[model samples]
Target: MPSKIPDVVAPGTLARGEQPVIPVPGDLVIRPWVLADAGAVYKAFQDPLLQRWHARVADSESEARGWIEEWRASWADEHNAYWAIAAAGSDEVVGRIALKSVVLADGQAEVAYWTMPEARRRGVASRALTALAGWAFDEVGLHRLELTHSTANEASCRVALRNGFATEGTKRSAGPHEDGWHDMHLHARIKGDGPTALV
Candidate 1:
């Protein structure tokens, strides 16, 4: 039988005004961000936890819109895919995820994400990742998806593990924080990992 899986996603296939909603279960939906989400995005970044992990400080709505524009440009450049994690029935930006450092030739990419304080502990990140990983593998024809987080972030560590990513090892002094550099842990899920299944 012919393969039903989609072939490699063509680079530059995702352009501005062309947001694709990755199919995944649950009440969540992933959508392309809009400038109107700037306020929510700005508020999420105000969390000290988020700011510490990302080393980003966008204290103003204007700066948040700038961040959204950068995300739009990433799609146009075909280097990254960033999505606003929102409720299925609403447009509020409760979280965000990104497939960064895309290499279509190598069929690899790095995945990263953060949830607003209200969105945590609700499986938001995990479901978002499961959806993104499935799209990256089943639809985008990616071979490998990588995730890295500071060793100190227990929440992200759990999210990675729950999303079919296996711990590879630690990158020493690879993470920066307000205090100083910290150790970083690497995890990865291959194309055949199969939907974050429980063993």
Candidate 2:
């Protein structure tokens, strides 16, 4: 027997137009990244942990600026949706998140994020993740949001689970990092997994 294809709004068609500021509880804000945020992003990239997990080092403001440009290009192409996490009522960016490798035809997207070194342990990632997941499911009409992190990265795993993403399994040696290959843990949140705030 063959599995029937899911009835979805279809991938690549969800992000149709203008992006807006998304407010989450706890005075957290998520908005599209801009060139003005380059400085903060560069500062974050200086964190050893960030560079370790992301496997990219930014030695100068110019190099970090390229990362921002790449993100902007991705947004324009609709290949990814990136955001800067900031304090509510402020333009200062403190962290980042994205609905990447989006497949609107399948009504699915992947969630990824990293908090500024100074912002860690403050629930920045969790709040941003929750707010974004809800928006993706309810407004963007996505059915599933996938999240993958290194098995050794328990903090990220906790963030995923805290946001209603259930662990499905692990992929052996799926991700390469500064140290070596890491087994990737996969988690996902489907529509209705939990409450999501549209705002």
Which is the leading candidate under lDDT?
1
Candidate 1 lDDT: 0.85
Task: Tally clashing residue pairs in candidate 1.
Answer: 0
> In model 1, where do residues sit more than 4 Å from their true spots?
1-10, 13-17, 195-199
Using Cα atoms with residue i matched to residue i, what is each candidate's TM-score against the true structure? 0.90, 0.90
Query: Which residue pairs clash within candidate 2?
Result: 10-104, 10-105, 11-103, 11-104, 11-105, 11-106, 12-104
Give candidate 2's root-mean-square deviation (CA, Å): 3.3
lDDT (Cα atoms) of all candidates against the true structure:
0.85, 0.84
Model 2 poorest ten-residue lDDT run: 7-16
Candidate 2 lDDT, 1-199, residue by residue in tens:
6538764765345446677678878888998788888889889988888887897777888887888888877865666888899988666787999999887767888999999987899888988998898888888788899999999999998888888899999999999998899999999999989833221
- Alpha carbon lDDT at 149, candidate 1: 94
Could you list the CA RMSD of all candidates, in the order they appear? 4.7, 3.3
